[model samples]
Target: MTMIGAQLRLLAWFVIPATLLSGCAPAIRLDEAATDRPIQTSSAPPAAREDAPAPHRPPSPTPTPVPRAFALNLYQEGDFVPQYTFDWCVAASIQIMHNVIDDTGGGTWADRVQQGQLWEMARARSSNSFNGANPLGWAKVLTEVGMGPYAVVSIADYGEALRTAARAIADTGRPVGLVMWRGRHVWVMSGFTSLGDPDQFPKFSVTGIRVQDPLYPYGDQQWGPSPAPNALLTPEQLATQFVVREPRRWSSNLPTGYMLVLPVAKA
Candidate 1:
């Protein structure tokens, strides 16, 4: 009987714990709970570029474009006039300038009689010019006859001289008078082609020049040949004939240099 009672007590203890353990929500083990979520991993950063500019320094400024090809021309079909006589070069040049600027259909000033009268007018206004029209006389006659407020200028440097002439023409819309062969002859620079626009850039260079030589087809032996009218001559070609004026060749306050009958703005 004692053995049977002890067996009943042990059976009751095992059955009661088994009934409590089979619950509505099961308790998960530590290893089983770890596998419920996905594993998270970290990676290294990318390498930097070697060619990039420094972060602390400011960026450099963009440079202005140079040798940007440009051209400006004022020559027309009928803007050329040949000299009536060897001594009437300036008069013919004045006539050509009048023809260029006038733009009116009928009153062309290329008549031989009119050219002679203009020569006389220029010569009458000059002094210390040996009875011919000098630069002063040429400028004065232009002013009086309503062609200029022109003035005489001398530049020591050849490149600067071309630049000055180009700038004046671009500024005033008038022709530049080049005192060719040391003030003995004259050629009118009607327009020019440059590396940059003269009106826009102060540092432009003259690449080619358009000239009107009154003595075309009759070039001098000592000096170079006269280019055809409205010829676009390079600076080197022009340098062959264009030289420094002799100080004693003509009387002026200007020192010995390349002479130009430059046009100035009217005040």
Candidate 2:
């Protein structure tokens, strides 16, 4: 019985120590600051990669670009008239202009007698000492007879001169009278081809000019051949015949430059 009691006490001591060792183990230490922060649980999508194409929504459609080229021409059949005499260019120009403005083919004025009469009238109104009609008289005759409200305009730059004439024709829908051959001749600007439509594009430039030289097939000895009616002339081809006016050729307050018997919009 004593031996049995001794064995029991030893076993109890072992069991008691095992229980104490497990129950008294030290707790793991935690960082206080880390523990105080809230967990991030936002449902936002991940950031897109820099090189990724835009999401399923298609990128805004690029605007449809305008056509890079354009053209406008007002010439039609029977719009051309030739001068009856060498000195009747202005008169012939007037007839052609009337025909152009009278697009309906009503009252075409290509009569030779009328041409002679018109020439005499222009010569009488002009004061060019050489007995030839000048740009001022040409403009006056156009205005006086209801074909006008025309004006003589001079441009310093050849290119700008062409632009102005083209713009005038495009705006007024009437022909522009070019004072060709150093203020000695006349040609009608009927139409033009351009990089952009003059009415739409601000920076439009002229690519070709349509001309009506009353002296067609009978071009001057100095200037080159006259282009047929409604001929599309390149800017370079036109510069040869259409030159700056010799201011001394006529009396005027205008500075020496390129000239035009420009059509004015009626009020």
Listed per candidate, the RMSD to the true structure in angstroms reads: 5.5, 6.7
* lDDT per residue as tens, model 1, 1-267: 999999999999999888887774568876888888688766966667899776797779998666677776677888898997899999998888777667668577889999999999888877644778888888888888887899989899999999999998888888888989988899999899998887678889999999999998898999978899999999999999999886685567888888888889878
Which parts of model 2 have CA positions greater than 4 angstroms off?
A: 1-67
The worst-scoring run of ten residues by lDDT in candidate 1 lies at 21-30
Q: Which candidate gets the maximum TM-score versus the true structure? A: 1
Which residue pairs overlap in candidate 2's backbone?
none
How many clashing pairs in candidate 2?
A: 0
- What is the lDDT of every predicted structure here? 0.86, 0.87
lDDT of 2: 0.87
TM-score of candidate 1 versus the correct structure, residues matched by position: 0.80
Instruction: Looking at model 2, report the run of 10 residues with the lowest lDDT sum.
Output: 25-34
C-alpha lDDT (0 to 100) for residue 262 of candidate 2:
94
